[model samples]
Target: MFGVEARALMLEGVNELADAVQVTMGPKGRNVVIELSYGTPKITKDGVTVARSMAFENRVKNVGAALVKQVANATNAVAGDGTTLATVLARSIFAEGTKSVAAGMNAMDLRRGMNMAVDTVVEYLKSKAKTISTPTEYAQVASISANGDAEVGDLVAKALEKVGKEGVITISEGKTLENELEVIDGLKLDRGYLLTNFITNTRTQKCELDDPLILVHEKKISEASKLKPLLQLVVKLQRPLFIVADDVVGEALTALVVNKVRAGLKVCVIKAPGFGSYRIDHLLDFVALTGSKLISESTSLKLEDVTVEMLGNAKKIIVTKDDTIILGAVGDKQVIQERRDEVTSQLKKATAKFDKEKLEQRLSRLSGGVAVIKVGGASDVEISEKKDRVVDALNSARAAAYEGIVPGGGVALLQASRELDKIKTTNFEEKVGVQIIQIAMKIPAYIIAANAGYEASMVVGKLLEKIENDSFGFDAAQGEYVDMFKAGIVDPVKVLRRAIQDAVSVSTLLTTTEAVVYPNYTSNSNSNLHYN
Candidate 1:
């Protein structure tokens, strides 16, 4: 297919997907009941979840739906929220772009103009963003992201307070009816186990060890002789051993894998975090935290000469494909504090942004602590749904802390649309692109109002009348116009900016496309198929 016909079919698909997703846009938005392949049907207000569940029988339309789905996923991956808004924006932009193209507008010029408008909107959002530092501010952001769940907001606020801005906050299902938050002393590393054979929990794809003896090595271990003594010592002690090393290869890695598989020894190996000087600093931090000796050439410590006393101890160690978390580390408080102080001192003196960030991460790991929010519900499906919301809220809270926030309920985007009028366009096609985005920005607030059973156009018009006050927006739940920020309705600038960026990126590509190709399956084709 080519030209208007192809674009029209794609736009229809975009509309179908967006129509289902936009309903779940605001606090008063309706929940979508999704039929599952097994067990109970899933009911959720998460836009990305709804988008992921949708498929079309028409291949051409399915292609369009898939592109919109990519926008949602990309937004989710970056900002962890605003996926619904991203989908809505993508559909609006592509639909408008399609109309312009059909009217003899240059597709490339439209794309260029769309990019310019988006960049301007992003800058406007940044200028208008307000940095949030207090726990109350965090709760407000969390509450809005979780669809006005005050309980979730409170839990997330508590979690962020306990963990600090740079610290890790994870969400999990709880055993009880009430949500719970727990703070623990732990260290998380970016590196994970070197081999899948080290995984002890197949269900979670993680290697979990209880009361493990941690061995921190600064250099690679390639010989069996150097590892034999440590294995023997761990076996004699009857304790699981966790190895953090520069690299484990050749006979040394093979020996550990064989011991894990055949000898039934509980052992896991992971590469040390960071690179070069950063790696050494991270290893040093780990050593200080675990009360282990740093096996480095500068210290004249050889792998063969390592003893049980040199190993660090931890209450529990969990290793996954991309990360490792050590909980309840058995380190002296004084030593850990001293290490933290050293990192703090270095952080103050660091001039490079990269170095400062790395130092801040070290300090956070040493002092900020870790928080786990266990989301609870009456049923499995309820728990799953709530957990998703909690995770999104937590991520949004973090993003808000990083890049600040803007008036939400789509007011920010609507106001941003006004700035597009100031942008200079070289051609009529380019001007149409700017107009497309200008119109698209208003769609979110409109859909949000319509979802709450109000007259969408009236709400949008009233809000636009007060464009001078950028924060003024329709409070759909209360059927009133209010200051969004003062009403505790806000969005992270990072989320909003990313949503628009990803939406326009994919939507413009779809707008410019002249043709699409799909497979032509026929009778008597091979039962098994392969793709590359």
Candidate 2:
């Protein structure tokens, strides 16, 4: 039967994981080189990746490691940052719980107390949050999370400013000119390439049509005779033609592809999106967007009915395997404006969450300008690290815009802990919980100070005393407490809250574990142990 030995095993494994991960918790944190099973070594400072690389032969140890990994992964997923903080917090909480349990404290009591503390701390954090307003503040938040890289932060801030709040930002790893970024007046379509053969540009694996004539038809075209007139007209214009149709089959589809292959005609066709009324609405939307008339069941479903007057124009159309994006749609300004107004009205009335999100996306497409950041590094390792940093910087910047920023460098957490001291708890569970959280809150700053080779207790104690109401705390790097925001040390409120929520969840769950079941012991293999 499982007893003290099992609990010890669990706690020991968890402690090891936490200690290794915590070493990489701060700005001055060290990197870890992990040797893969294939004998390739990779170095990184990312807590989630480091935690994931660790493996244990003992089941109980593995279980403990798994719990820590879950917290790291979940924290990163919610906030796109703060993996290291979450790992360190979870480890600290677990260590405290183990100590209390050893001193005859009930596991359930500890769990309840921690839960109450988490809620209280989170609420307090929200109250202390200051919404980021200036571009300098935005850059500060981005830079802190991007390993103090000011260039990355500046890039993200400028790019976001160009794209607006609702505009999309896409990141790709590639080589380009230094500090190069592009903003395109484009729309991200939901429809992709209809056929691989239709992809005109093999180099980019995209079907790029320049100033292509757009035709939106709802009916299938199965006969070459039906398209003969439209083909003749397109040939006469000597411009590429893009057909968005319900279906193009039989000789009509074959003839179009054959002619394009033989340089007889320039044409690419894709299936129109949606069905029934939805299909009709999308067609109508494009009608205003591209100034294209619909040749549907109502318009006499025949290519003979297709005329130059019905054709719309797009400055550039790129059809990829996943979707089609159009730029500079040339349509009647009045028609497009009217359609935009209608969508805006619909968006206001959209109640369901999904409907609201979809409407918002539609509105974004109507109002263009999407920014793409092409990030590059000299090596594979550098590129991978840069990509992660860029993403964290972007997300942190957006989070700052969406909510606000708070004092960083453990100052906020220390301040949040002080908040719990103001509340008087009658229940013993809540009181104990508050006490635990108060200690847990100091862990981050303490670890940060320790990582810098300074006395943790002295740094944290001074911070706890100095940061009473205002946002001020010890800067581990400077060895003194100062106003965090003024020092350009800030974090997203969302990221901090998310990290605490996930850390408490994992820590509380791990605290109540009474047993470590090693099932099917005989079948177990690969008994070698590993650590990071």
Candidate 3:
């Protein structure tokens, strides 16, 4: 167990990580070149990547850094942008809360204040956000996120506009031109293989098949004898087969592997998608996707029941541990429509117990189209950096399209902080919480100013006096106060809200951390390090 010393150590570590990350905060911020021990160096301003690249000699600092990295990861996961801002905000809260904790302020009071501050800031952000409808507004958000790359922004905005809001966007390295975006028909499946045995080509870790027949079965195939007739049919037809079943156990699995590896028969077997009864929906979706027949053991138990006419044909199927994506699927529009209608009706009938995101995603998959922005650069490092920026732009544009936009350049947060400061709170805990967030709000502007070679204190003071105009804030690049929206500097409201919420959560947890227990430390240790 540890007390003051541990807290100080933790704070120092946190401060170090914050110092390393916050430098890459705003548009005026500089890029960090991360040199790995066994790879080419990477140059990026992405906060999450930078934080992950950092190493601390001080064990305490490393521990602190690890905790704060959660903020970056969570922010990236939810909004896909604002990792740096979130990290900075969290550091500020943790720093401010540390002072309060040292002054004998109750941890519970600080935690309570943080919660209230999150609610207030979120509400304030919502109030300030402007609805985004036009492609131009989306372009602005994307441009800012892409580090002022107008081409990337314009391309992403146009792609999203063409594909509609429900459409998916993905990025890949390109061979020609700095890049281009293409819209193609496709669907994403959440079900992926856990074993590599299904992949016939070990060199590429891929199972390549041409016009493979799909078998959607409802029961487990435990015996090789049960699968023999189907295997013989695949051999007779001289075409690859894809079997989707509940489970292919022991002899059945071995037989398929032998037939594929030794006899050179193309066979790929994967467990039917989804969990429990939901697996039925997945199998149905696959049937709709490929226009395959729904074959179940409940309907026919005999091997002869599997006929060539009963199987569906797919152009290609790719599997990975995370997910499976079927490409060039020959879709039956009528069948897809029927399945979509069924899923929609199920969704309408679904209670809160049903997973809404999953259902909605399934519907989107059924709709079927993906826009890919293949980013290209002169060098590997450039490509990597450009890829991150384009992805951020894509995600930021999507968020803006989904939720709307907020005034950026730290204007929204500063405005909310000031508004909270003016709020009259009778309770001491509430007042303290307001004060902590209020102070923390200025951190973004301060860091932005400092990064741009301006006096942070002077810039923050100037911006504070312009509170009358919520849109006006210190534009570090210009070293003057201006309207963030007019300057084409805006962020998705969802990104800011996610950052603030995660920051408050992590900061509150840090404040309540009273001790650091090193599990590996023992009194019997002969090393110099000692703890009591």
Per-model lDDT = 0.90, 0.79, 0.80
**TM-scores vs. true structure, each candidate:** 0.76, 0.80, 0.76
Candidate 3 matches the true fold with a TM-score of: 0.76
Top candidate when judged by lDDT against the true structure: 1
Model 2 residue 445 CA deviation in Å: 1.4
Q: Report the lDDT tens digits of candidate 3 across residue range 392-457.
A: 888788788767887787877888887686566657866787788888888887888899898889
Q: In terms of TM-score, how similar is model 1 to the real structure? A: 0.76
lDDT of prediction 2: 0.79
The collision pairs in model 3 are 13-61
- Report the C-alpha lDDT of model 2 over 1-532, residue by residue, as the tens digit: 2656666787778788888888876667777777878744777777777888887998888888888889888887657788888888887787787766777777787788787788888887788789876778878888887777788888888777887756777788778435457777776666887778887778988888888898888778889998888888888899888998888999998888888888656677778876665676677777788988888668664568777888999899888888787888888988877877888899888787666656666666555668877887776666666777788888778777776788888888888887777766656655776687788898888888899889889888787778764677766666776878788888888888888999888887776776667654344456744332
* 402 Cα displacement, candidate 1 (Å): 1.3
TM-score of 2: 0.80
Runs in model 2 with CA error above 4 Å? Answer: 1-3, 37-40, 176-179, 188-210, 216-223, 226-239, 244-250, 257-266, 270-313, 318-325, 330-367, 427-429, 477-480, 523-532
